[model samples]
Target: MIGVDGQAMNRFQQKIELRDGEALFQVGGSVRDRLLGRTPADVDGVLLTPDPEGAGGRLTQAGLAPVVGRNGGRAWRGRGIDLTVWPREPGQPVEEALRHEALQRDFTLNALYSRWGIEEVIDPLGGQADLRRGIVRATGAGALVRDPVRVLRLARLASGLDFQVDPATLAWARAVDPGLAAGERVGREVLAWLTQSAAPGKGLDLWADSGAIRAIPEVAALQGVAQRADYHPEGDVWIHTGQVLDRAAQLGQGLERGALGVLMLSALFHDVGKAITTRWELGRWRAHGHEAVSRDLTQSRLKGWGLGNRVVGWTVRLVADHGRPMALARDGASLTGWWRLLDGHPCPELLFLLAQADSQGRVAAGEGEPSPPLFTAGMPFRAALDRWGQIPMLSGGHLLAAGVRPGPAVGRGLTLLRRAAFLGRWREGEPIAPLLRQAGLLAGRAKG
Candidate 1:
């Protein structure tokens, strides 16, 4: 069934060919998406005719709301399709409009267009050839250098398309000044591009190799700094980070933008501190206390990068608490230990995922044997978490309800009770009565 917009696009295309004696050329991502088998929300059309301005009246007569601003183009929200017009080569028709758009767009692969309801795919810039070859070549070196944002775009296209950038383009991107990219713009684009990747590590490597990684100094510094092979077969903290990013991006597929944003930033900066704290142990290297160091460093970097407080706060929490999972994996750590460590943390699951990714990286790097089975070997790790999820037999809120006065004792009693409960020394269904009695938290329940 042709929907209203599809029908409108059909009608509009035919009328333009008849009245203006010109063909409307669709450009940009709309064309790229169509070739990629995706439906786009809007289409950009370049009109080839003597009086491109008069085409607006005809579109308005066709019952479209024309938005006038930017690009010297009018936006027509009509017949179920939102369309924009870029006038090129007035007094020409059809092919000229297509040619004009191909000349102006940034990348060769993004310049191809499809004729509405026709089987014809236009490729003036060898865009289709680049798409077929899995190559991202710039339309021209001049156009690419005009906007430094293309450097980021080139990175995104290479990752998103899983294509190799042309060597010339890669060379150009590596030498561009960071000042050409506004930090806020880079930040926003990085956050957005992170969503389109299946493996952000590959993307990060591309960024590093292209010098985009150096644009953010703190992250770039992590490269090649070693972590102990006993703990990290993944070679160094930087190498492990790339693997973690790949894992995170894989898991984050289909997640919301906000969730993906958090995950990506967390993956990228999760181990940024290892560059500073690495030291040689008895025989191998170890990054003792790097988790704490990373948390502090990430906070400062995120602030400098102008990231939101919510993102920075959660990422810091994830980085700080990342080591807890390895501790949990150890059979000796008591529930009280786990509970104490996680007492104020947010999003324990995200932390665990990072830990697992870290472990996976180690194993992949031949640092350790594959992790034990999730049921038996992995059970203790999970069981401790499951136990932690249960509320303590008593809390400050519960103590206050039990007639325990609101004082430091109430707070103190809750902590002690929770500690005992976490250790399994406190039984379930037991009220704050016995705990209050023992701690002198209540009059009859305590002695004093």
Candidate 2:
């Protein structure tokens, strides 16, 4: 008899039975997530039938537009449910089909299945036990070798579920050929970990531990790269990056998804240029102009991974300007400086958060205390923007109307005038003509 848990399955089963009397079994993530007390993101089912064509026809005749695959696989995609016919030789028994399908799955936790009206889970691979134990284990021998993409999936599951991978499974993942999967597929897996996991750095650490980081050469190069001890007591660039990424995630808890992704990615790739730009200058390490280098590398690597243009652009901008907030704060820069720093960037708040995280992630040499918060300088700067509004009192157009020629000189002149006003040298009600005259923009007398 169908139970409460099987109500959804009963409806699915009724539809299948009404068409061809075929049995549909729930499987994969749908069963595993539900068993873990988390709402499953998607539901997938397996139709137990030897006649793939007949199953497809029946599903179609039942008014479900099934996406039929070349290998005779069928899928009903709406309502977060997916249905596929079992892969079996013609005339194969349903029991054998179920067993073969479960064995082919990547991880034990994902190889679970349950049928409508059945109280027990159908687990031929001990997936239920693994799920209960909160472990990610391979289904059987050659599991990762069967599909190298599973190596990335292993990291994703570990990060997403906050579970540990079985030692043997990790060993198998380490041994798999990373080149077996294409870059786009591997990128998708890494993207999932970056965007979906609560602690993505842990997933990256697992990937590094499993030697899967070699798949992305850019990230793999971060290992063992030293940093200046005085500024970064965190040992190396790679370790500092992990701390920064986690700190960024913590600081960006309530951020929008796209903004959070950009912030995290910015932290991830912030110091990539340190690997190339590091040099022992005057008996200390220095990475002059690393920001520009890191920005270039970020663009190339993200494009290679096939990320969208918006993401690539936003991440590159963050990487390029990551140090600006800190630098401005240190210099006690005025509102004009802050405005100039945030002029092109759409999310200035995220940049400030990143600066704060970057500051907190570093340690003073031989000290246990956290780094001082440099981003607090943004407070006054933001207050100034809010008080004065984002619009400047004067523009290049004002200079042109004052007889200043339209050229690079006019742009430079207006920049100076704006800085003067932003620094409070010009009062709120003060006329711009006096400032223009003082700057020599006006010829003889100030016009009222």
Candidate 3:
């Protein structure tokens, strides 16, 4: 069932010019995936041969712009294949060199290798056996500590490759400092786990077990935070958050790239504020103004990751308004309130999707999916959107034409006009009135 490339690999083997003792082996995910009956999108190879020009000189001469890492090894990334080559000892036997390279991989499953143009796999650490056993075992005792990124990588592989981590390896992973790895690398690993994994919640549970929680203390703080049993019969804030992420992964399959990234990040941080804002009141717990705090915390976290302003801005707004859809639909709000929800918004659909996921996350044990109204397409959130979208476009430009001076008053006047027009209380061309005086206009305002 291994679908390793044949003719193309044979051509590569002929071009690399292997000497008697030298070898070029396709290694890591490519070989492992091929054995698992999946066509790996990316192929990794290690050439146990040296050239006077450099480790990747053969490939570069064969048309690649390889980069040399700090370790003096060269990595050439091109098309679907990424190859790394390091200088090997003169007259070193291929078996010994391949065994040494295999021992250096982070996990035994990744330690598997296959020679170019050869069908047989050279498993130096019995990675093939571990692969069949569906286990991810460290190649060395110090592997996790040596590269703490492996802890997060385990988060990905847990669901990505559908395998379990060896208990001993998990123990070692839990002791390593996640900060030892680059933050950007950490972010990418986490994003992949949440976005690509079918069970992002379980992957994060593994992450927390591996001490990757040290990477984001905000999330770790959620572990024991309380929620009212009536509304959140499932469990604590952390458990609720996990459920939300898994629901979001299903809900977000329709989204892609920055949009999906925003949804996932919003879902992760949507309830973070509950850790600080939850209070005992009226005989139960309440997070009266958690969304605002969550919005702030989410902004800080996203900025710390050096995310772009557009993604950060949208995610922050979504976090801020996470409770709006259901609340507004049930109790209603000012036209300006709902307008502000979607104002300058790139995608309200994503916001609603995250909100739905948040709502779906909390449930009693053994209960089915939450009922619709909040979950449906004709959701009150949508009605409000339609109403707001139809607001008379008597914009700031129109007011300027009417000779109204530019300032806060002009904006306020416009909002009032829109609010009045939104409820059909005042016509678009009618004289503006005090919307605050209207009976329906002052029901309530959104919390900060």
Candidate 4:
């Protein structure tokens, strides 16, 4: 076990040090975070000892649970520490094991290791210097080829840490075989980057720069697509999407992780259909019915990425109904219209946030500032939703119990009653006979 001169150790560190190992070094993000003066969220340790089995036995004796994986690697978990032993290969020198392990890491910055209770960092791959320079450099040419998921990780690190990718590493990422990475892995990485990063647009920019966006053919098609200059002075569809994503991230800072993910993903693909539906009509750019097209595209792309049904459903709904608020405002839609729109959506608040970001992302022609005219127009409608509850005041069960048959006519009558309630024409707790007569669901009683 390794010991230090004056530094105090936490429980996990103290317990691990009591084992009979040459050294236990804190590795990966834990070491890098400590050097950066940030609190490490998770600490992982690597044990270097000749007796691997002995080390595992000692950890188990200390009450740490052994977690075995499909690959047969053993990891010990306790007190928020994850400890793993490096297995020594047959006929390999023990001295070269550390360097060999370091080379297998995805990036230079993550290859760092620091011995427990010590001030020194083990930099076998020059990771410390790269960290100082704020650069994400791949350890070797085969780094990406070994695990293609590193491509998305490279983008995630660049955005999450606000670091720049080395030019050579970017080129290497572009030249690698795309089929080596699984769609599920890429989707998982993208979701992490979207939800966890301060500015996910930077990660997307890197994805575009590395040519990794081609994995989603629909997203790749967004490049160079034009929008109406009167509304979008931000150049092409891809540029506008990046801007909207950044804006949405800023707007959704305090939201729950799931809501934030939905908003960001919606913003990222809100305009995807422009690539397919854009056309020259009356000598200007127009994308009529693009919202529906975008929704279809979103469903297919997210399904291919292995996203769950709920996420896919919510994201597609957001994309499809993204323009409703503005359209309703333009048409001066009544309270019933707003209620109808909100009734069909899973989360009206998320849709409004996405709409706000969409409105704020555009640079109007001859205007230096981003004008959110639609957001201003939709404010009253949003306030009305808050005044009333999210769901309709009445239900189809009420109509069914009122002697209405369970069929298409009953559904239509319920919708009419809900609309009447929204318009203040119907009151709760009142006799339903009058409303049923108004809805043509009941024969009127002859008055005396």
* Clash totals for all candidate models: 2, 0, 0, 0
Question: Model 3, range 1-448, lDDT digits (tens) per residue?
Answer: 1235677666666766676446788888888888988877667888776462454556765554665552354577664567777567887777788888777778988888887656589888988899889898998888787788888887678667678889998898888888777766777877777777776776667778878777877888899888888777779999888888888888888777778888888888898898899999998999989988998998887787777798789889888888877676566565556767666567788887888898888765675765422463236677777776777787776654544457765676577677666667777665443343242322244111
TM-score, structure 1 vs. true: 0.75
Q: What is candidate 1's local distance difference test score?
A: 0.69
| Estimated TM-score for each candidate | 0.75, 0.78, 0.80, 0.81
* Backbone clashes in model 4, listed as residue pairs: none
Evaluated with lDDT, which candidate comes out highest? Answer: 4
Candidate 1 residue pairs that clash: 49-91, 437-445
Candidate 1 residue-wise lDDT, 308-401, digit = tens: 8888888888888776667666657666667766665776656666666655554343455455223222455567667667754445677777
**lDDT tens per residue, model 2, 240-298:** 88778767878888888788888888888888898889888999989899999999998
Task: Judging by TM-score, tell me the better candidate of 2 and 3.
Answer: 3
> Clashes in model 3: which pairs?
none
TM-score, prediction 3? 0.80
Q: Listing every candidate in turn, what is its Cα RMSD in Å to the true structure after a full C-alpha superposition?
A: 5.9, 5.7, 6.9, 5.2
Candidates by lDDT, descending order: 4, 3, 2, 1
Pairs in clash, predicted candidate 2: none
lDDT pick, better of 1 and 4: 4
Q: Residue 169 CA error for candidate 2 (Å)?
A: 1.9
Give the runs in model 2 whose Cα sits over 4 Å from its true position: 1-21, 54-79, 88-93, 116-120, 363-448
For model 4, how does the per-residue alpha-carbon lDDT over 1-448 read when each residue is reduced to its tens digit? 2122223345545555553435677777788887778777667667766667777767776556777551156577765666767765555653466677678778888888877656688888889999999999999999987777787788788888889999999999888755467777778877887888777765776777876676666777888899888778777788788778878998999999888888988998898999999999998999999999999999888887888888889999999998888888888887877887876468888888898888877644454644444466557667757745633566777877776667886878777776666677766766666777766776546121
- If the candidates were sorted by their TM-score against the true structure, best first, what order would they fall in? 4, 3, 2, 1
Relative to the true structure, candidate 2 reaches a TM of 0.78
- Kindly give the stretch of ten consecutive residues in candidate 3 with the minimal lDDT sum: 439-448
